[model samples]
Target chain A: MKISARNQIKGTIKSVTKGQTTSHIQLEVNGTIITASITNEAVDDLNLKPGQNAYAVIKASDVMIAVD
Target chain B: MKISARNQIKGTIKSVTKGQTTSHIQLEVNGTIITASITNEAVDDLNLKPGQNAYAVIKASDVMIAVD
Candidate 1:
């Protein structure tokens, strides 16, 4: 979905696992692991899994980038 | 905190608002909204807001990317 905000990155979906009630989706973007939780139905529709490439679409008002 | 995962995006913290119990931090990366919920304490420590660049560190098992 085209959410209102700014900060979209192309990410590779690494894996999709089942959470308690929400499904946990892991994305690999620039060698970083980006995790998001969605509904079970969403998981079924996406048909996600490991090795599958996807995007970690983030929609928040606060984005924090930490450096080493 | 350095999380064990891959998919870290360098985003700018657009805004930091108060949620029920957790603090909602909005992040802007490439014109997308990447939101994350942190504890109130974390929010206080970070002292985040708009224009502040941060990283939307996602650590999930499933990442989905949709196209038009």
Candidate 2:
């Protein structure tokens, strides 16, 4: 399905750390690790595993800007 | 204030569109416009304006992953 999020970078699953209600998925993209925190149920539904390719989907609205 | 978000990219405020409850903040980072949906209260608190330097903060939990 198509999403409205502007940022969608391709990466491979580096690791998956499951917590009580959430899971932290480490995605390795060009030597950089982008961490994504998703629900444990979503992780199970996606059947995400290490060495699998995935896309990091981030909504523009979710992004916040800070000033120093 | 210190935040837990890992992704905090420096940028400049390109524009600020305020709505009734929410506001759309456009931050220009390296020629790319990163849109942020924040509350109108935040805009007022931060006093965000155009051409001002800022940062785009994104939490890992807010990030999602998709597979092809």
Candidate 3:
């Protein structure tokens, strides 16, 4: 499917932490680990698992950074 | 400073919504809007405002995607 996000990093699933409403998903991209929070229903729909290839689609607005 | 995250998208601040503890920041990247939830403290620390150049740094572990 087509997504509007600018950064789509290709990675493999490392882990999946399912919560009551939200699910924490971990992806490994080039030795770096990325984590995302999603809904449990979405997890069931996607059937995400370890070793599977997925893309981390990041929108410029969804990322928060701090500078000193 | 170098961060552990993999995805760093450059964009301009579109808006900032402050709440009790968390703040939502919207950024425009390449014509696409990206929204992020951050702490109010981080907002003040960074001095975020509209029209400022900021980056959306996403860790691979933080991005969750679903495919149908």
Candidate 4:
């Protein structure tokens, strides 16, 4: 995926705070906090949270996931 | 804040599609698509999406907003 965000940092998942509806995803990218509020379902689906080394991929276009 | 990602670009808001729980925020950063899934209330509170020129700020650390 091609992203065009001016600030892209590589970070690790420090924590994943779960809320009723949304979850706070904390990425420790370069000693900075890059948080993304996403749905609980997505969290479960992605199996995300702390200790999972992944890319905080941000795209310039509207986010759409194609399961193919 | 200091981020440690290798990539970063500038972009504009292209569109915002509202979902039941999460909203798809489309950002046109340097002709690329950077979509962020945020809460509907955040979308309303920020009054974000389309035509609004803002920064797609991504930090390496877990994202935390300090309300001062």
Q: In lDDT terms, which candidate is top?
A: 2
A1-68 per-residue lDDT for model 4 (tens digits): 44454224355778888889878787665564566766777778778868776556544332322110
State in Å the error of residue B27, model 3: 0.6
Q: Which digits, one per residue and each the tens of the lDDT, describe model 3 over residues B2-54?
A: 88775676778899999899888887766756688889988998999999999
Q: Which of the numbered candidates is closest to the native, going by highest TM-score?
A: 2
For model 3, the docking class works out as acceptable
lDDT per model, in order? 0.63, 0.87, 0.76, 0.58
The sequence of per-residue lDDT tens digits that candidate 4 reaches over residues B1-68 is 44543223355778889989888776665455666666787778777757887655443232222211
How much is A61 displaced in model 2, in angstroms?
4.2
Better of 2 and 4 by TM-score: 2
Total backbone collisions for each predicted model: 47, 3, 11, 26
Q: What DockQ would candidate 2 receive versus the native complex?
A: 0.53
TM-score, each model?
A: 0.52, 0.69, 0.55, 0.41
Better of 1 and 4 by lDDT: 1
Q: How well does candidate 4 match the true structure in TM-score terms?
A: 0.41
Q: Which segments of model 3 are wrong by more than 4 Å?
A: A1-62, A66-68
> What is the lDDT for B8 in model 4?
36
Residue B6 lDDT, candidate 1, scale 0-100: 49
True contacts kept of 2: 0.78
- TM-score order of candidates, best first? 2, 3, 1, 4
First chain of model 1: TM-score?
Answer: 0.72
Q: Over 4 Å off in model 2, which ranges?
A: A6-12, A28-33, A50-52, B29-32
